[model samples]
Target chain A: MAYLDHAATTPMLPAALDAYATAARAIGNPSSLHAAGRSARRMVEESRERIAAVIGARPSEVIFTGGGTEADNLATKGVFWARRDADPGRRRVVVSAVEHHAVLDAVGWLGRHEGAEVTYLPVDGTGRVDPAGFAELVRAHGDETAVVSVQWANNEVGTVQPIAELAALAAGAGIPFHTDAVQAVGQVPVDFAGSGVAALTLTGHKLGGPVGVGALVLGRDVACTPLLHGGGQERDVRSGTLDTPGVVAFAVAVETTVRAREQYAERVAALRDELVRRVLAAVPDAIHNGDAEHRLPGNAHFSFPGCEGDALLLLLDAKGIYCSTGSACSAGVAQPSHVLLAMGADDARARSSLRFSLGHDSTEADLDALLAALPGAVERARRAGAWKTPR
Target chain B: MSGGVDSAVAAARAKDAGHDVTGVHLALARNPQTYRTGARGCCTLEDSRDARRAADVIGIPFYVWDMADEFHASVVDDFVDEYAAGRTPNPCLRCNEKIKFAAVLDRAVALGFDAVVTGHHARLGADGLLRRSVDLAKDQSYVLAVLTRAQLDRAVFPLGDSTKERVRAEAAERGLAVADKPDSHDICFIADGDTRGFLEGRLGSAPGDIVDGRTGARLGTHNGAYGYTIGQRKGLNLRVPAEDGRPRYVLSITPVTNTVTVGPREDLEVDTVTATRPIWHEASASVRCDVQLRAHGEVVPASVTVAAGELTARLETPARGVAAGQAIVAYRPDPGGDIVLGSATITAGTRESAHA
Candidate 1:
């Protein structure tokens, strides 16, 4: 089977798997102080340091959580509560419209129940947030704003944002900025300290590690409240028993992926470009989405006119080719991609789009498999067209 | 699949028959929590999960097809409109006609599937004629009669030959989790089974007088004319007793006049049922047949005539409480009246004595 949906979650690296298995055989919680516990604790701290060194953060700044969603929730809610507690007047949150549901829903909850006035900054047609528009918002409501969030890269369209510039604007206004860098760490160069963001979120599974483990990289001076309150772990910002095996596996994956990112990016980006060229040639009306120059290396998203993405996905699945529609499904109902809608596509165009993301193991043979199956699938899906309620 | 014993067993049987069967559960509810409150309704999240689990045990791929838009436009809206017109419409018939057969079947065929296999207790014979299930208590041929020959040609109902008890036994034997799940009854979309309250929320209160049919005297006041159905004997709430001191049943509801007419129960009997928009498997100028007025209503012998897309059935023995908006389904003459001849939407029903 050809797996082209790596952006959703890539396969685990072999070294990371070995690390997880080796750690799993050992026993004792990192929180315990006995000899076995100290051994486990050493492994956890070393993993934290390794992740910190690679991401350009201090060891204390890397607070491990359950996963990317948890890290995003911790950063968004935690930073908002901390800022609001510091100054009661700080009740406004500024976020980009193209953020994944992890940050979007967390901020949405705060707005719905916590009396937060949210300002959703719009993106350009390429799904990139403009620093100038954000600068204007900061100048207008700088004092009242508790936090600012803009993702480093969009998961759906793979459009990389101007995070350093946006972070500077938020810093100038004295508001903490957070970026959900879950999709960026191993694909592009991510330097936590150099990016100048107060906090950032990264997960393990998206990179080549085990699931259910991730870290929130917060600056030393960033005062953030805790989302979880038990066991006083991870410097009191996150409080769960450390997942030692997952953490070790995550660190191993991070180090290996980051070290080889330059070469990996070149190889996958070449394959992705070939895919985009061939698909457009095969189906002339198909529109490639996202900024050509500022996209993730392995990401290629397209909109096939007059076709429902779900129908195409199913047809391709029958041919042993797997991909995604890059939209959230609620109770099996395919919602139009908010990222595509934010990029100025209509509802039909948003629903018609599909995402094909190559990964570490992806090769030309996988692309050939997709190209072979895509034309027939598109024809069948076009025949199905959009579902119209018969009058 | 409907996440019930019959559908689960049907899917298993189809797979056992060596067809490439893929189970599909229609996500008819837009918001499932609001649609089905608990285990009482179909298309709930729990129902979808149950369907998926059954598919896993049967070892087939399963998908939930979101048909919420089509369902609302065709079934739900038509239901409210029919009531506003003072008619008691069977939403299940409308759902089968528009959604399960038309929209879903079209999509399935477009996706290269040979046919749609549903759990309805109706037989589609190899000769392409629709027939009643062997189990009369659970026969759904009346609801499915609205489907055209084209739709029925691509439809498969595997549970038609077996009784509900046998289907449940098969499900249990096959290790399906929903073997004992309660058969979904009433309207699946009406979560609480309060049809009046549901209609009242949509078409708000329009107070009208309840008048005696013979005397033309006002007997009581009703919140809305749509709330009363023909032949309803309960909840009339009449302030005055009848002259003969017998209970009065609802005879007619006139939405334009905003009035409900009540009289003796015998007045509910109608000898002729005139229906429009006939869908026929076998059409003729006239046919002697048996007609069903509503779901689970008695089958009565009738002589039916077809003309200009309308059908009029004159019952040999008059039937009681036949309402407009209900389907008039004709079947073959009955030593065994199993074959479905045709169906149409009832527009009017008149007593023979009134016409005479």
Candidate 2:
């Protein structure tokens, strides 16, 4: 089987697996003061320092959580609550429209339940948030805006945002900015300190570690409220018993992937470009989505004019080629990609798109398998035309 | 699969028979949260999970085809409209005709699948004729009688030979999780089983008079004429008692007049039923057959004639509660009455005594 959906989740690296197994054999909670506790604490501290060093953050700033979603919620909701509590005037949140549900839904909850007024910063046709638009929004409601969030890279289309410029605007306005860098750390160059963002989110599974482990990198001065309250841990901002094995595995995967990122990106990006080229050649009407230049190296997205992405994905699945529609499904019914819709595509175009993300393990053979099955799947799906019922 | 034991077993049996089977659950409810709250209906999230698990155990590819919009437009809307027109419609029959066989089948065939396999307790004889299930107690051929020959040709039912008990036993033997799940009863879409409340929500109360058929005296007031069905004997709450002190049954509902006429139970009997929009598996000018008027209603011997796209059937013995908008499905006269010959939508029914 050819698995081209690494952006969803990739397989764990052998090194990370070994680190997890080794840590699992150890006993005691890091909070317990006994010898076993101290040993566990040492392991946890070492893993924190390794992750901090690799991601260009100080050891004290790295706050471990259950996973990327928790980190994102902690960053979005935590920061919003903290800012609003500090000043009653700060009741607005500014975020890009194309953020993943992890960030979008959190901010949406803030808007609905909390009194946070949200301003969705629109992206261009290629899914990039323009810096000028951010500047205008800041110039208008800078004082009321509690936080600004734009992802480092979109998971669906792979369009890298102007995070540095957006962060600079937020800083000038004296507002805290957060970026969901879960899809960027292992796929691109992510330096927490260099990016100038107040907080960043990264998960382990997406970069070849175990699931259910991730971290939030926060600036020293950023005051954030805690989402979880129990057993005061992680500098009193996040409270929970740390998963020692998971933290060790996550750190090992982060270090290993970051060290090999440059070479890995080049190899996978070349394969992705070829896959895109051959796919477009085979199906002439297929449209490639996302920024041509400012995209993640291993990401390739396309829209087949008259095809339903779900039907095409199933057809490909039948042929042993796995990919994604890159959209949320409610009760197995595909909802049009909000990212694509935000990029100015119509509902049909949004529903017609598919995402194929290559990983460190991708090869020419995988791309060959996809190309062999794609043309037939597209033709059959177009013929099906079951996306919209004729009245 | 419907996330029930029968469909799950049907999927397994089809796979066991060496046909490439794909399990599919239909998302029929617009808002699925309102459906099957505690496993009494289909299309709920729990049911979807059950179906997915069953598919996993059966070892086949599974998908959920969203037919919510089509179902609302075709079955739900048609049901409300029929009721508004003073007719008692069977929504399950309409769903089988418009959704399962037409909309879903068309899409399946277009997607390269030759047929759709459902768990309806019905059979297709070797001659490709629609037949009642051997398990007569669980027979669904009445509801399925609406399918055309073309639709029936592309449909497969795998649980016709076995009883519901046998199907449940097979499910347990196969280690299926839904072996003990209770069978879904009443209308699946009507969550509380209150058809009156459901209709009232859609067609708001148009207060009307309930009059006695013989005396022409107003007996009571009804909130809406559509809430009362022909042959309904309960919930009348009549203010006046008949001179003979006999219980009254709903005889007719006239929407235009906004009136419901109630009389003795014998007045609800009809010997002649006029129907339209006839769908036939085997068309005939005139034939002696047994006709079923509603989903589980008893069949009566009738002489059925077809002409000008209309069907007129005269029953040998009068049938009570033969409501308009219910399907009149003709079957071969028993001892071989299991074979479905044709079906039509009842437009009107009249008592021979009234004409005499």
Candidate 3:
């Protein structure tokens, strides 16, 4: 199979797999204080240090959680709750329009059930939140704003946000800033201290690590509530027994991907650009989504004018090629992408878009297969008619 | 596959027939578990799992395609709109025609599938016609009649030749757990068996008069004309009885005037049923057919004619309780065959004595 859906989850690096296998054989709970426990504790701490060093975070700031969603929930709810407790009037949650459901839904829950006033900072046509637009929202409700969350990059459109500038704007307003860097870390430069954000989220699977492991790099000065409260590990922000094997593998994956990011981006981005070129060459009117210069090296999203993305995805899947559609179906009903809507595209365009993200294992050969299969799929899907949604 | 025994056995039969099959259980509702919808509703999470298990036992790929939006638009909304106009609409017929055959089948074909397969108890003849299921009790050709030539040409009903009893038996032999799963009944969208409440919630209450169709005298009042069906005997809450001491039955409902006309049992019988939206299997011409009104109701012999975009049928024997918006499926009844020839929606009907 030509697997170009790496942004969804890439294959685990072989070295990371080896690290997990080795750690799995060792039996010790990192929480316990026995000699065997101390050995596991050492492995967890060393992994923490390795991840922190690569991401430019303090080892103490990296709080491991089950995955990216958990880390995101902790950041939004924990920090928002803490900040609200510090001052009850600080109930405004400013999140970007293009955030993944992790941050979007968390902030939404706070607004709905917790009485938070949410101001969704809108993005430009290319799905980018200009620093000025974000700044205006924060300033308009600066005193009342408890938290500001703008993702490092959008997962769907692959438009990298101006995170440092946006984070600095929130900081200037004395508000807690959290960026979900899950998709950005391995593909871009993400430094907690360098970006000046209060906390950030990263997951292992997206960066070629094992699943069920991620971290929330939080500043020591930030007082946040806990999502889980059993072990009080990782500075008490999150509470769960450390998955030693997962942590070790995650650490290895993060270090390898981040270190190799520069050369990797150049190689993969060149191929992705060529893919965009060839796909457009095959289907003349196909529109590329997101800002061309500002997207991730591995990301190539397009909107075929008359095709249903899900139908196209499944059609290509039958031909041994894999990708993702921005639109997600619930009960056989496909909903147009909110990100594309925020980008000012109409509903049909939003529903027609698909994402093809390259990874470390992706090659020109994968591109060739996709290019060869795409035109026929698009033609068939168009003939199928834009997924007949309910009137 | 719907995770039921019929679909499960049908999938097994298709696979056994040396055809590559992918079992799919359509998620017809967004949140099936939230409603106390019972086994009748197709969208329950349990049903999806059952389909998955059947696929596993049969060693075929399975998927739950969410078609809730299409169903809601095509079938659910149509049910509400038809009732609001004081007509009894068959949601099953709408689902089969619009969602299952047109929408879902079209997508399957476009995705490279040669045919759309379902467990509906109907036969796809080699002549490209749909016939009745072998099991008359389990026959579903009434709803299947709405499908056109294109849909039937690319459709596969694997459970047609076999009886429901044998299908269940095959399912048991195949180790499919839903072998004894109860058949889905009634309108699937109307979960909880509260059709009145469901319609009330959507159309709301519109008070109107319930009058005797013969005397034109008001017999009682009704909460909403939309809630009443043709030939309904009970629940009218009439304050007075007929002069002949016989019970009253709803003869017709006029939505524009919000009036329901109730009369003696004789008024309910109609010898001639004129229907619109004439859909033909082939050409439009006069032919003798066994016409079925309800999906499980009786089929009476009728001579049907098609012309000027309308279909008119004269029943050999007067039939009662025929309602507008219900499908009138015509079946070609030969000595050894019952094939669905065509169908139309009942728009108007007259009593046998009216013309006499």
Candidate 4:
């Protein structure tokens, strides 16, 4: 199958795989005080420095965690907790409506179980959060606010949010700003120093690094209370036995993916434009789901009315051309994409959206395969959606 | 033509009978995602796709007319309102009456279809009267009781003469993907296995009191009385224990008072019921027949009387737990077995078990 769900995960690069294999051969936990442990610890520190260098963050700022989900939770809840502790009354959290469930569900938990209040700032139809509206909210609730978190780019609709502008508003309030830049790290230009955000999250799986490893870059001045307290790993913020192989692999992937991003993006964007053109020519009135200009170069989302996204996806899958309904995470739930709905897509449009994401590995042949299957797929899918009702 | 199993099969049969037929499946889900969530039923994406695929296999043109907004306005909203009013609503009957035969079928005729076909288990008489299907196990007359004659005139049911098993066999023979598809039993939208969860999710928590039916003593706190139906037994979460330790059954729900009354199972039984908006399958008036309250409910002998405003049914053997907001589908026996006389919504019923 021509896999197009790069938003979910990607194949690890040869360099990353070699880095992991080399690190895996070494023995000893980094925490132990013995010479073997010290040797392992050196490799981990070296990996951290490589990761920090590419993201323009200091070595001390990189805190390794389980993966994207953990990084998102720590950035969202840990920062909220830290801010709340610094000023006991700073209990409100501002998050964008288009956040991944890792961030969205954590904020929901805070609102539901914790005493903290959460305000979901609405996004425009393009899935871009209005920085002005966020500023208005921050100014209005400046007293109770703990932090403002908006993803760097949506995993589904792929609209890149104006994080620099959004973070500037939160920064003015002296509130920590965190962005889950999991999708944006390699695909788009990202600099921790340039973005001026207090903290940022990036995962390995989405950018050709092996799964189960990610990092949260905490700015020098940012003080986040540790979510996991143990042997004081990752600057005592996230304490766990380091996965040296995974960390090394992650650094290699980030370095290589970011370096080649420009050329890769140009190629994929051309193929994506063609995919959209041919899809529209085949299925007229098929609506694109996000802002055409602001969307990810690799992402092409369209809502084919009179057809269910799931059914269409399955049909495409049968043809060995795999895609997704909206996001891979919520594939089986059968609810209209909350992200699409928040972006002002009506129920029909939300139900009809199919996301086709590309990556460095994507090629013209993959696009051709998708285009070949799409026209007949849309027609059959629409026919299948029909219900014979009584007159 | 109602877009259902019986009608779908009838359309195929009619086509097989060498008649020109077009199959149409109405887009009745306000959002197909609601019903498709966790694979609910024939309302699912898979099912709709299956129906369309069957039409395609039969070499017929198929179309899906958007009736979602109308379905929500007519069926889903009414269902929530009825539950809020302390009554149990049958959404299937409402869909059959309001969307299937009435609304989409009207649109089908407008689009130049000779008639609408469904997979309903009810049969039509030689003189063109609606009757119960030959297969009693698959009879769906109860849900179709509310469909009007004018609506029925353009309706067809191919599965009426065949049993569900036969339908499956035929589906298998034709290589139809959904020929052996499992019959959908629950409400399509509420796939979380909790109607209360759906209500709570949509309507934010409304604090209410759960009280003992006899003493009026507060038994527990309920999120909303609107979430509880007349005969619901679960989710009471009562702090007070019954005398016999049996779970309490819902006896009444007073939305105005915001109170849910709970009592022993015996308190849920009802003997008599009055229904409104009756439609006859064979004639304009009433007759003696068997009434089934629920989809799987057994038929009980009853003398049915109908007027322009309402229909009164007095069971020969009093029924039990006959809650309000249920459809009263009547069935009369003929050469085909049982024919549907039509149906109405139950407005009131006796408080105790008439069967007991």
Reference-based lDDT, each prediction: 0.91, 0.91, 0.87, 0.79
Model 2: runs farther than 4 Å from truth? B333-337, B353-356
Interface RMSD values for the candidates, listed in order? 1.7, 2.0, 3.3, 9.9
Model 3 chain B lDDT-worst window of ten? B34-43
Worst 10 residues of 4 chain A by lDDT: A326-335
Contacts from the true interface found in each model, as a fraction, amount to 0.48, 0.41, 0.52, 0.00
* Cα error of candidate 3 at position A389, Å: 7.8
lDDT-superior candidate, 1 or 4: 1
**Candidate 3 residue pairs that clash:** A331-B66, A331-B67, A332-B66, A332-B67, A333-B66
* Model 4 lDDT per residue over A1-391, tens place: 7999988888999999998999899887888899989988898898889888889899999999999899889988888888888888999998998898999999999888878898898988888898888888888898789877889989998999998998888888888899999999988889998998999999999999999999999897887877788887788889889998898899999989888988888888898898888888888989977878877889988999988786677568767887888743321335678899998988878888899999888887897898888888887777655542322
Summed over model 3, clashes come to: 5
Pairs clashing within candidate 1: none
Ranking by DockQ: 1, 2, 3, 4
Model 2: colliding residue pairs: B334-B337
**CA-based DockQ, model 3:** 0.50
Docking class of 2: medium
lDDT of 2 by residue, B23-126 (tens): 88999888887336554557888888889999999999998877788888988888889999999999899988888888878777767889889999988756
Q: Candidate 1: which stretches are off by over 4 Å? A: B34-39, B333-337, B353-356
TM-score of 4: 0.60
Query: Regarding TM-score, does 2 or 4 come out ahead?
Result: 2
RMSD of 3: 2.6
